[model samples]
Target: EAAVTQSPRNKVAVTGGKVTLSCNQTNNHNNMYWYRQDTGHGLRLIHYSYGAGSTEKGDIPDGYKASRPSQENFSLILELATPSQTSVYFCASGGLDRGTGGAQDTQYFGPGTRLLVL
Candidate 1:
């Protein structure tokens, strides 16, 4: 299983400001994902990466940017933070299943980062 971690477990941002969330994985997983968890609503996809130097937009990519400079690191950037963006962010790492040679449905998740926008 991959070990995932996120920085600044808690944060307070102002509207129209910038906020950056960072994630790192110990295991060399080919896929990495960013998700946000909110009240009344479940988790929503923000962005994802297939491998180093590759990033893809997920279901909710607006007002956010993703960067995957290396296999072990991925970052989520909010150029203009908003109150609606206040939520708990999670990072997950997943790869193929050796047994089936198929994508692994089980992903290892980070502790999560909580952001409160003012």
Candidate 2:
């Protein structure tokens, strides 16, 4: 099973400040993703990584940056936080399924991080 955890479950940041959200996974999955949940937009993908040392821009990657330093760690960085970015962020990990030997559509997600930018 995939086990993902996120740090700073709740955060309050100032406008134009910097915020870093961290995620760690123990499933050894090759794919990791960062997403933000909003009321109207639902869950929007901000960034994703295929593996360590590789990062990719997602559907909504304008102001967000992602990093995957190791197989178990992935981080989301907001260099200049804004009030519009305030939302609940989630980290997910998924990849090939050992049992099925096929790509797993099931993604294990972290509890979520609530960020309030003011």
Candidate 3:
């Protein structure tokens, strides 16, 4: 029953500025993730959280950051946005953690927030 929602379906920003993408879930899932989908990069994990009050760096944590203040909210933060970072960002939430021996996770992806850095 995890339903993920993202804010600002589209965004335009200047280089070196900051961009903040928001996400909210209603299923009380313990895991949340942020990913970027680009032309050739496919889906790249940017950051994730195991649960409320905890944020973990994901595979590509170089230009991104994440925060999970509660069980229903997770936010992705771009300290300094760049054109190279222009891409569609997605937020997901699930109850299971595959790496933790939990059942196969059913990640619910958001509609995606398209970011354009100029």
Candidate 4:
């Protein structure tokens, strides 16, 4: 029942421009996350939100920002896009039911958006 979608499946950006990636989910989940996958760096968490109107910085928050306006929408903003930031970005939505003695978190991910910076 949980579905996540991303917009502008592919993007080409200049060295110093800005790029915004959009994501929408239908699960009404409480947590949303943004991640980037690269050759050497592997998959890294860039940003996340606990719920609507709340964005939290992840492990690799530099050069990236996140916005969650509603229960089903989240966006990632690259203020100054660079070549080093060129990679496949993915959005996921899910959360754990922490009240039950530590429930596992299972996130549903959206189709990735490939970005290339020149």
Q: Which numbered prediction scores highest in lDDT against the true structure?
A: 2
* Steric clash pairs (candidate 4): none
lDDT of 2 at 4: 97
Off by over 4 Å in 3: 96-104
Clashing pairs for predicted structure model 3, backbone only: none
Candidate 2 — which residues are off by over 4 angstroms? Answer: 100-102
Give the residue spans of candidate 4 off by over 4 A.
Answer: 96-104
Give each model's whole-structure lDDT. 0.93, 0.94, 0.89, 0.90
lDDT of 1 by residue, 1-118 (tens): 5689999899999999999999999978889999999988799999999999999999999999999999999999999999999999999998875755657566889999999999
Give TM per candidate.
Answer: 0.92, 0.94, 0.90, 0.90
lDDT (Cα, tens digit) per residue for candidate 4, span 3-113: 899998999999999999999998778999999998888879999999999999999999998889998999999999999999999999987644444333778789999
Candidate 3, overall lDDT? 0.89
lDDT of 1: 0.93
Candidate 3 worst ten-residue window by lDDT: 96-105
* lDDT for position 55 in model 4: 99
Show the colliding residue pairs in model 1.
none
Residue-level lDDT of model 2, residues 1-118, one tens digit each, is 6789999999999999999999999989999999999998989999999999999999999989999999999999999999999999999999887776667666889999999999
lDDT for 84 in candidate 2 is 92
